[model samples]
Target chain A: MDTLINIPTMAELSAKGEQPDILFWVGCAGSYDERAQRITRAFAKILKHVGIKFAVLGTEEACTGDPAKRAGNEFLFQMQAMGNIEVLNGYAIKKIVTACPHCFNTIKNEYPVLGGHYEVIHHTQLIADLIAEGKLVAEGGAFKGKKISFHDPCYLGRGNGVYEAPRKALEQLDADLVELKRCKSNGLCCGAGGAQMFKEPEPGKKDVNVERMEDVLEAKADIVAVGCPFCMTMMNDGVKHVEKEQEITVLDIAEITARANGLL
Target chain B: MLAQIVFTLVFIVAVALFTVQVRKIIRNIRLGKNICRNDRKAERWTTMARVAMGQSKMMVRPVAGLMHLFVYLGFVIINLEVLEIVLDGIFGTHRLFAFMGGFYSFLIGSFEILALLVLLGVLVFLARRLVVRLKRFSGVEMKAWPKSDAIYILLIEVLLMTAFLTMNAADYQLQSRLYGHYIQAGAFPVSQFLSPLLPSSTEALVFIERFCWWFHIIGILAFLNYLPISKHFHILLAFPNTWYSNLNPKGHFSNMQSVSNEVKAMLDPSFTPPPADPDAKFGAKDVVDLNWVQLMNAYTCTECGRCTSVCPANITGKLLSPRKIMMDTRDRLEELGKAKDKNGASYHDGKALLDDYISREEIWACTTCNACVEACPVNIDPLSIILDLRRYAVMEESNVPNSLSAMFANVENNAAPWKYAPADRLNWAQGDWSKE
Candidate 1:
């Protein structure tokens, strides 16, 4: 899993008198969460493999204020949003992509209302697009017959109505992709949405993540695929909760694609 | 002459009671903050037509939807006959619309058919609640008076419709006998079947007709007054609720004004943020903090449990139920309304809707998924209430879950929800992948 490629930063590109085709918004989870870092690297590998001109905002990147807003701190959220908008408007960045559904949703849907507008895309959508254009070929390789189930992230599935792009990315792998009983629009949350990722779940009959994990387990897939880093964390935790960590692996669509393409 | 005088007195009392209830409700709703939803006139009207008038969203469950459509039509269309009843009571006329001949017959016949359908609908609804054991109807929130209120409304409608039919039956019986004051006029086909069941003596028949006529009219008045105190208040509020619905994209949440202004000031070089009011509430601490439309939504809740049934959090055993949120708002609003009525206009007993009615755990459980908003036939936005309350908890009270506190700290200093500084954001792309 050696991802030693030279990653260009926004500052570096500005110094080079050039701009990348897309500004990769490496979200908080992707930037620092150990489990989510793999997703960031995998997506970066796919971007490099496809020869797409992409650059990370690097140190210049800040959160899109999704969690802050969802947590009901509108003041903090707007402060963060305004700061990012200033930097983005300064650089005149046009197209942006991120592997985190939370960031993608905030930037695409919430930012424009705060005076920041860009062509925002999620990484699965990018991978799906690349595969469709035949620019990046996903051969399935070792994953040809593997059982994989995609857990739809709330922001990606219900928030954004993007049930197909992730599936398309998985389809490129030629793996046996399965559906949870409550997939697509009726998909359940992984208990990490609405800023719940930062808070312990309130006392309930059952944790939302454990309940959602039951659906994944019922599907009995060896590999659980996710499109969002938040979903990856929650689903991976769900797998661990049931002590099925040795039997099942939770991964992002980018990781699966990267693995299938021999990049990882 | 004596009977007409008594009818006038009864009418005056009923109207007075109904008017007082309505005025009280309006005043209570006014206690809420103002919001401007008047931007989209055509869309608002269309929403009212489709949701309140057409019951379009109700049809998602065909059996219940069609049944509700029948009951709704019965309640609306049968009221036209009340116009005739009122005129007759005031002017000492028998069957005031009888002069219209065929049209009167047609209207009466249609009313009879609708009444029958309404009776059947009410019966089925009652069965669903009492016998069929629908889980949504028998929840903890719906215990005691909530359950009784629902059953009582259904039974009252049954009684009203039955009284109307009985009065029609007695009138038909008297008309068949060609009694002096009982004109041989108007249609009564459904009641015609019930004419044989009336007492043979014209004296007893007149007594039956007069008793039912008074009962039916008085019951209608009672129902009108009861609406403000009942979940069936939706009967009056749904039209306006649907009309004032937020027509924005379902995923979009309205930005707070104070927050937006501060953000604008931050972005502009020459701009300065407005002076903050020390007494200003951050979000909703009580019903007074919520917008009028949200208060209207509280009144508009039918308590059908459709939103709660589909709520993912509720489905997964979370404490959050959108139905309960609306109910709690209405209950707290009612409590506040009662206090204002009892005490002075400036009354504040220190109880707020936040902890008193709704809890922090319930508000936090919501994912803001808009599932409840989507499921609401009347377009009640429970998510908005949840967000506002959460806003109060986080921004004003500084009382969020410990994990959220950590995330906030990270966002403030590290520019992310994680502990890593912004400079190390690209570490994932740089080194140490071999450790994996």
Candidate 2:
């Protein structure tokens, strides 16, 4: 089973022995963000299928306090971060892996202030690794036959500079990709973030997801694939209201990859 | 005499109302707490001079910029004519500086030429709004009673200028008032050449000048005082707001302070606990709910619509509009300010973070992308406010999206916002690292 946190101090890490090959850190987004769990499960299953021996983490993990801090509760975030670091210290974990882009960014970028420092990579990079190793061969050239679109989650592409990894992973999966007009640095918000998933958006002239879905529809793709869980929920909700029975499906990169590997 | 007295009283009343209205609008924005507050005094002044005063924002579009420039410059130049009327009222002389005929005539001619240019400029602005309807230029266009008031104010100024020029050449007596001046000495060239045919007396010209002058100055002053309530309030307050605008590092996140600064607190790995800080501050949830500076920004918007134009979420047709953000802040601040004054306390219970003023989705929908600020000519950073609100949602309320919760957990445990840990943190860098 994967652990929930990262070991920030070297003393705790040294006590346990040399840090494990990877400290598997499962974030709040992954555990509770419905699509994230499905995507993460697919990524794990795919890696396992291809003979990769990665440790599982965060089958039981607490929130990182990003939402608390963002919502103006800095004190809570600090408490949560400290508690999470203790969980990692017990295992002497130094290196880490994450499926959530926001988690990847926060741990890689934020936890250093809390005395947590470790190498972290998104699952997309791991998939890129799997592709590079030639351990798993792609089965179908037919996968690229139809057009597909990718949504860039803010934390993944802009916050962490991991723009190309996911796209490369998609290319490896042989997806015939179409892109929204605003991608990469100018990505659209899916309207499901910053605790927006917990509460309804204020009623206004339009829903942010509805606006973003219009872009996917404008791109005219057969399937809309996203890397982030929030993007999946928002795009799904947006399409549900606007294009019922429209035959367009929303899938995460991991799920898509799992399908490509004939594991789905 | 009775007619003049009645008109004077009417003009005074109009100006008073205009002044009252303008004050009210500004007061409302200050009271709402939607402004960005930080150590930004220098930014406020510099941006006000560079962006607002220089009309740098208007220049983003060439044609609109040019038209606005004319109106702005014309309004200043027209002030000379207004001063001339004030003097005539006191001295009872139709001629502006009649003692210096040569200079007075030249000044009059120059002002007339400038007024004509202003008319032409105003025409372009009207056409853009009504005829061209440029996408970038479009906004929540004011209409109905407000529109009528706006038109009424503009028309009065235009008519006074037109009539002044006509009386100069077309009015026989006023034409003689210029006497022998060097610049365009011939009255026939201007419309007032025929003024001698009407009432060729000094008293008649004086009477006419006062009539036109009152219509122009009184109308504008009246409008000015009433501006607080009117949509045109931006003209008065945009300067101070722009001058004090945040000029700090763009997209700079507040340094996250540590409440539990102990690294050893987590070494044993057995506990998951919330903070025991009984008096800890959570995220910003309302007005008076914000620090002084974020509240100040609500007061400074020029309403030039630049933020909305650059907003990616807005361009995508999201309900989030930056322009509306400022407007709603102004609206709510006014509401709260009144209550604060009335009750000696803030009306909201620390959660003034109202959906009615600024929608919750609009607040969270922002990706901390900084596009709105980058596009703002006045340099109002909307991203900071968005992040501040996010902090409140996550920390105080403990109501965050599952996505962020996942991110928080991953970063805390594995140093990544992911559920499934990668066996290798840098899987792509592995081969490169070994070779290096």
Candidate 3:
């Protein structure tokens, strides 16, 4: 594994009077959260191994204001949105790929009206497309015959109707892809959306993550794959809650692809 | 002549009262703020055709969908017989459409078959509610009136279909006996089974037929008027509601133009801001603040609880029930409409939808995952109302939960939801992934 991966920032690319093919939007969770960072790295490794030119916004990127918008603070959401739009438009960025469904959803659907229009896609979508093109060959070296189930993220699945892309990426692993009963459009939430990640769940019999984890457990998969950073956190917590961290693994789709393709 | 006069008077009064109630409902819906749902005309029509007219969304649960389709098709097709009934009631003629001969018999045969299907469907629906007690039907919002309203509609439909079949059975027997004005112009495929049960005397058959005819017509009229007040209103409103559905991607929550303008003015000193309306409120506090499409959605809800049942929060025992949000909005709107009717338009009951009807706990408990919106058979958007109510709590009243307050502050200051510094955002990249 490459310990010192050379990642270019948009600022450096702009100073060189050059532009990459895509701007990697390392969302706040992917940037700061310890677990999600592995996903960010795995996805970056895949992009690099496939020779796809991409640049990160580095410190210049801000939250896509999804949480704030969901929390009902339109003012704060717009402020963050406008700030990010200014930076994105300044870079003349045309296409973006992110590992966070919240960022993917916000920039793809919500930013056009604020004068920030660009083609935004989730990392799983990019991985799926790359696999379709035969750019990243999946040998399923480590994950061969493993039972894996993909958890649908709210913003990515029901919110935007991109259910097939993540599944397609996972399909490349050549693993026994088990499905949770509540998958696809009917998938359950991880209790972290709409800014619920920032607050305690108002009195409930079971945490939303625990309820969702029950579906994962019933599916009896060895590894539960996820597409979004928030799902990563919630599903990981759920695995820990059930003390199945040793038996059941929670891996992001990109991480699985990275391992299966021998990229990491 | 006396029977014609009495029937016409009852029909006129029923229609007039129905018109009055429908107009009031339209007025209540119009009380909401205007929105431009007219942009995608072609797509809107297609959606209406597929969802409402075609009953596509109802088919998500095949059994319920098929049953609903049976009842719906029966109600619409059988109502054609009502046209003949109205003409006969007015002109005092018997079986006026009998002039069409065999074609008329074919039509009545189809109506009889459809009426039987409707009866069977209604009984199953009643059993689902009362006997099976589906968890969706027993939601907290389904208490009292909502629960009973569903049962009443099914029972009424049962009665109407039964009366229709009995009227046909009595008429068939009378026609067989060649009684006065009982022409052999109709077919009774399903009701033929009932023909043997009628009395053999011609006079008794005439009395039974005439009494059933009168009962069926009056029941239909009463059912028509009851629609504007009951959840049965979905029968009429579903078409328009599906037509006005949000055609954009489901993830898209509309940008508040009012907030965008204010933010632009704050950021760019050179930008000239439009003059603000003094009456502008930040978000929805009551029904009037919501868009007319949302208000129509409230009226279109059939209290199916499909939304609440699928809600992740509700499933996990959180207070957020999307169906309840719609119910509360409709209930509050009805209350306001009544108050306005009694005392001029300015009347305020001082009870708003936010804290009074839908509590902060309920709205805050929402994950805004759009599950409810997706599950709605009629495309009702309870999430929009929940978001708008949350906006009222956050912007208008600054009454957010303590946890979200910190998140709001952090987003405003740190550019992220957490307390992490902006510079540390790139630190994740510098880590030694080889160690793992």
| TM-score for each candidate, following the candidate numbering | 0.89, 0.58, 0.99
lDDT, candidate 2, B1-436, per-residue tens:
5655665666567667766655554455444334344455666666778887798866866776887777777776767766766555445444446556667667766776776777787666566556786565555533354445455545655675566665554334444555332123322334444454555566666566456555565655655654565445556555666766655433224554433432234544564445555534544566545544555566555455667876756765656767666656555676776676677753543336555566666766664555566566555656666666666676666676555566566555554445445343323211221111
Candidate 2, residue B96: how far the Cα is off, in Å: 4.7
- Preferred candidate (TM-score higher): 2 or 3: 3
Task: Estimate every model's Cα lDDT from 0 to 1.
Answer: 0.86, 0.61, 0.91
Off by over 4 Å in 1: A1-3, A45-52, A123-151, A160-186, A217-225, A243-264, B98-106, B172-196, B263-270, B312-319, B431-436
Predicted candidate 1 versus true structure: per-residue lDDT over A11-119, tens digit per residue: 9999989989999898889889888888888888888888889898888889888888888899889888889998998889999999988888888888898889999
lDDT of 3 by residue, B164-250 (tens): 899899899888878777878889999989989888888888888888899899999999999998999999999999999999888
**Ten-residue region with minimum lDDT total, candidate 2 chain B:** B427-436
Provide per-model DockQ scores. Answer: 0.48, 0.12, 0.77
lDDT winner among the candidates?
3
Q: What's the true lDDT of residue B232 in model 1?
A: 88
Q: Rank the candidates by TM-score, best first.
A: 3, 1, 2
Candidate 2: which docking quality band?
incorrect
The residue ranges of model 3 lying beyond 4 angstroms of the native Cα positions read A1-3, B434-436
iRMSD, per candidate, in listed order: 2.7, 9.5, 1.5
